[model samples]
Target: MLQSPVEFFRTLPKKVCPECGEHIQEQAESYLFECERCLANKEE
Candidate 1:
């Protein structure tokens, strides 16, 4: 069976930041999964 890209993504669970438990808004292609705030903090 084949699934459309949109359908495949919709079936996946939402991503959350491991550090803060905040919902992640990054795209699926993002190499890092952390949310923006956590990523910024880690870079400091």
Candidate 2:
């Protein structure tokens, strides 16, 4: 189990949003691998 917040974050695969330069958390592949905001707009 994770021992702290820093350790938890260190385990995640985070990257900058290609469109907006915002930090994005990498989620599961089935979740679409996109910027949260961009993905929302794309669905609209």
Candidate 3:
């Protein structure tokens, strides 16, 4: 049985920070992507 694209993504792994190597939690309510690692690295 074939699943929908949305369903496929729901089962797929979530995005993570390439710098600190932390998971990037999704915040659909707000139109923003907050990356702790990237933010910290940017300050350096």
Candidate 4:
């Protein structure tokens, strides 16, 4: 059986940060940063 959006998001895999070794949550948006600190540091 297929899972719902809520279930999918709940079971989403997090990505690791290469710079500071942080786990980033899966976001619905396409253009996302690996970590908040990285994004704030202009890693985009």
Model 4 segments more than 4 A misplaced? 1-13, 31-33
Q: What is the alpha-carbon lDDT of model 1 when measured against the actual structure?
A: 0.83
Estimate, for each residue in 1-44, the C-alpha lDDT of model 3 and write its tens digit.
99999999789887776666677887766442447668866889
The clash number for model 3 is 0
Best by lDDT: 1
Who is ahead in TM-score, 1 or 3?
A: 1
Ranking under TM-score, best-scoring first? Answer: 1, 3, 4, 2
TM for every model, in the order presented, reads 0.62, 0.46, 0.54, 0.46
Q: Where does candidate 3 have its weakest 10-residue lDDT segment?
A: 28-37
Q: List model 4 lDDT by residue over 1-44, tens digit each.
A: 99999999778677787778898765666555558888788755
- lDDT by residue (tens digit), candidate 2, 1-44: 64799888778666777777777766566444457898788889
TM-score for predicted model 1 compared with the true structure? 0.62
Cα displacement (angstroms), candidate 1, residue 4, comes to 6.9
Cα deviation of 27, candidate 2, in Å: 4.1
Q: List the residue pairs that clash in candidate 4.
A: none
Could you tell me the lDDT of residue 22 within candidate 1?
Answer: 89
Model 1 lDDT tens row, 1-44: 99999999789888788899988876646867788888788899
User: Which should have the higher TM-score, number 1 or number 4?
Assistant: 1
